[model samples]
Target chain A: MLSEKHLPAFYALGALLLIILPWILTAADSSYLISTATRLVIFAIGAVSLDLLIGYTGLVSFGHAAFFGVGAYVVGILAFHNFEETTFLGFDGTLTGLIVLPLAILISALFALIIGALALRTKGVYFIMITLSFGQMLFFLFVSLEAYGGDDGMMMFEGRNILPAIDLNDRITFYYFCLAIFTAFFLFCHRLVRSKFGRVLAAIRQNEDRMTSIGIRPYSAKLLIFVIAGAGAGLAGALMANHTEFVSPGLTHWTKSGDLMIVVILGGIGTLIGPVMGAFVFLLLEEFLPIIFHELGMDLLKEHWRVVFGPILILIVLFAKTGLYGLIFKKEG
Target chain B: MTQLFFEQLLNGLQLGMFLFLVSAGLTLVFGFMNIINLAHGSLFMIGAYAVAVLTNLTGSFFLGLLLSFPVVAAFALVIELLIIRPLYHRDHLDQVLATFGLILFFNEGVSIVFGRTPLFLNVPEALSGAVQITDTFSYPLYRIAIITVGLMVAAILWFIIVKTRTGMRIRAGTTNPEMIRALGVNIQALNTTIFVVGALFAGLAGGLSGPLTSVEVGMGENLLILSFVCIVIGGIGSIRGALLGALTVGLVDTLGRAFLPDLLGQFLDPATANGIGAALSSMSVYLLMIIVLIFKPTGLFPVARAA
Candidate 1:
């Protein structure tokens, strides 16, 4: 792996490139890359948070997209009501990021608290199923809501949230805004996994019984991180809603949770920057693989890229145990 | 209203039978092999597709159903050798990821081969009409046939597991694979047998349900999660638990969707109640699962050795 002391230089290089990517894309007249980068950054945020839970804490929550959807729905619902000039539960809808962002975080964190309290009681396959069950419940709940477009999903015509000093309606501006958020969360997770609390979580993952014998209850620490991860995912969700201008039950589907997990694992679990890199690689593959297939005259493969993508994923799980990051930054002898 | 209630109950039973067929194999795989096979759903889908294509070709649904068993079993055998055999020693996370990858490949592969348009399998002529259970109540003949077959399978499985020598060996294997291996039994072959049998049942369920539900690319996925709910609620590694859990989930899901709106309308205005009821009913099974886990974390009938 990359040496500990050189990690900051890698981070600086990544940051510098991300900062100039949109401008470079614009110069190339490939402004669509900005939106793509925005999606990558947003998902990177989600992947980083998931890494904290699955990698650092060793809690493989299969239902994490619930928080992501919850955050998007907060933004989506508020934007919908704001457009309709209606009050939802005696509160007028507002599009201010200052209000909506915090609300999204708080609500998603609360969701994690309730779900964590119940699901944390189970371990191994049971925990995975219970979390998936809750995620499905939330997905069906959203799908059943006819007022929000139900199975078809809802679009925000009123546009992105209002933030002070940032015009998020501009694609480049939003890309930078999302990059900033990703950087903040990425750094937060980096610090968190190194802290004393992080060590406890690591210990709990390594051997819960030993941790329990040492008087550190695994439940509370796990719950705490679950909430934190949920909150971070919620922030990413809100950004996702703004980026797409659409929200649907699909956002909360268990498959979305699976995708987030794939991102983490593909990037290299337990490493903050790995998921960030994984996000970049994942979206790039999603974007370019079909075009590449089309260029190669494999029209059938182009439309069914997942046929190729799936085996690649399987091979990664089977052979690339350390992931793309670990492969690139091989540990020195 | 009573008639409607009875009809919905039968519908729930039929749904439960499907859940049982799928979850039985899943629970067995989890119990014996200690693997979480998400691609089990893909097997169900292939079964549906197999039966659909064969039925269309042979002009006989029963023939198609009979043939799908071997087809799905063959596919299962291949999967066992290539993907699952290596995964036995890996952790649950790896199994989940690999199987999840398998789901993608299978779903997309089916879509590529079969096209995205949903396939419709006609109910075989003999079972197409309704059966008069009572003067006032009639149910689809096909549905009743499904329930009967499900029960028969359950009984046969019980007999095999409880009475027959093979069943005893299977049970012994579940409880103590190493001991069975020490006794000169081919444990790997035994595992393969259980895996293929499980796939056969899942295939059977898919072929049976094809007529009632549209045969589609991802048809197995929704049912897959519901079966997972059944397995979780029933307790991992317990066949009896799987049955109870499957029936409970099926009945609750079907009945909740059928009656929740009207039930809630009685207490509140129709419009608001309908909306909330729709959401709540959709969530009812998950709520049931959460409540069950709260009370019995190991599931209703958790197997001792598996735990």
Candidate 2:
């Protein structure tokens, strides 16, 4: 029913341009474009993982940022100790930035495993609140940990570990590394969705009761996907800390979770690439809207731009059934 | 020390009442509408603003209190008609996002209109002095008045809900919206009324609280989360549950902050005890919530059905 030959050549052109735009934009804007793009890519990765639950699995987690924050805190706490110091484990203390990422994933996944196991038992509004309650639990934990800069947050004075062969701190190189990670994740997520596992996830999304009728335990599937999503988000958080060289409660705030959800909805659910585009738009709006408003001497509007942002959401949900991606590509003729 | 303890208990009760005022409407909205309204706090903020402005305009506390109900309820009606009504048909994510967006909008709007500086209101002279509770403890008469007023309001609300016709429709609609519709109730009007009731409750809390705390921009944001935790721990929709949850959270929170340092000081060095105490104090409420969730996933007073 579908053929690569029939897909528009312009689609390929668009993808190429997306990749190239960052390179050119970074050249013109220096590190801003690269860092911004990297941030968008990181958030996009998290969003795709969320898509596995929210889009494919039909599970909505208002507390997804708990994982994101967990990943970030792990990176922060590790670096707080390991920035220049040796570890208690007796291993070489100075591993590269890439080495810390998997650790962050495991730590975040472990936390998610515990929280999700309990949270998944409840359905509907209970599910939302339980997840939120767990998120708040973590938030207060971080807030109370005056040991790690507490509410104000700590700055990473050190950047990513310099690979023995190549400098990891170079803006362009770091940008590419992040870009490669994003591309790999996108492809991985694409393949994941096509796998038979994706089909079960979809079935569970449609009806867990029926899935259980067929002998597939929905709880394990939901928990597994939740942890996977958490791991994915955790990776994004690790990259986020490395890219910005700072980690704060801002990463874990419920509002950030809401922002991530907004991105997924804006990009269109069930589509792997939608969140990437959505993240791009959201970050672009954050970057540019204030500048435009300030330059126009409407600085008052700067603080209150959500007045405009809110209406955009109302309009988007009302008029655009899918999202910007859906609007642009009309479900393949 | 005994006096302070007594005072703090009263303070905790006062805070619990404020939480109740906010939580009652929030719980009703959540329980009946199945809508997680993050913007409920915005209504609280709006109520505070209303009180602040009215107090400034008329220089009368009663006038401000009197006016906030209608103003806040009217605002709720408009919001319900425009934004929230449509969301009833959608899923929780949609409701969450739209309400969250409303939070941003309302917070920024208030900040712009009212400025970031905290607004202060003075309690009327009639309620200002301390009442001699004990020889060592002289609690603020104003706070005592707040407690009396809060208790009265809670009682009236209980009475109205348990012994009123409108409350029946709300209870019915919450349990079964389709059945209520099938019974030919005007669900739209009923929903708007319940939303208004919720708004008025929040507004009343705000009006009552303006003198006690700083009425500044973004005041409602954090309180919103805390109150949500209350309802979640209380079980989503039960009035009695909300009250119990609020009192429990208020006491645990206050007691932790008050006594945790002293408790830890006995075991550890003073500095470490202070740090650990503060951390534990902040965490104790959430710990209680998680413990409750662990044992009773449906919350203490399972409203709809046990999970």
Best DockQ among the predictions, by candidate number: 1
Q: Show how many residue pairs clash in every candidate, following the order shown.
A: 2, 0
TM-score, candidate number 1: 0.98
**What CA RMSD would you report for each candidate?**
1.3, 2.7
What DockQ does candidate 1 score? 0.81
Output the lDDT of residue A39, model 2.
Answer: 79
Highest-TM-score candidate: 1
Clashing pairs in 2: none
Candidate 1 residues A1-333, lDDT tens each? 566567779889989999999889989999888889899999999999999989898888999999999999999999999999998899998899999999999999999999999999998889999999999989998998899999989999989999999999999899989998888888888889999999999999999999999898999999999999999999999999999999999999888999998898999988888898888999999999999999999999899999988889888998888887787686545
Q: How far does residue A49 in candidate 1 sit from its true spot (Å)? A: 0.4
Indicate the docking level reached by candidate 2: medium
- Where model 1 places Cα greater than 4 Å from the true spot, the runs are A1-5, A331-333
* Structural similarity to truth (TM-score) of each candidate: 0.98, 0.94
DockQ of every model listed? 0.81, 0.65
Worst 10 residues of 2 chain B by lDDT: B298-307
Per-residue lDDT of candidate 2, residues A40-157 (tens digit): 7788888888888888888888878878888777677677667657563565444366667778889888988998888888877777777777777778778877878889888767
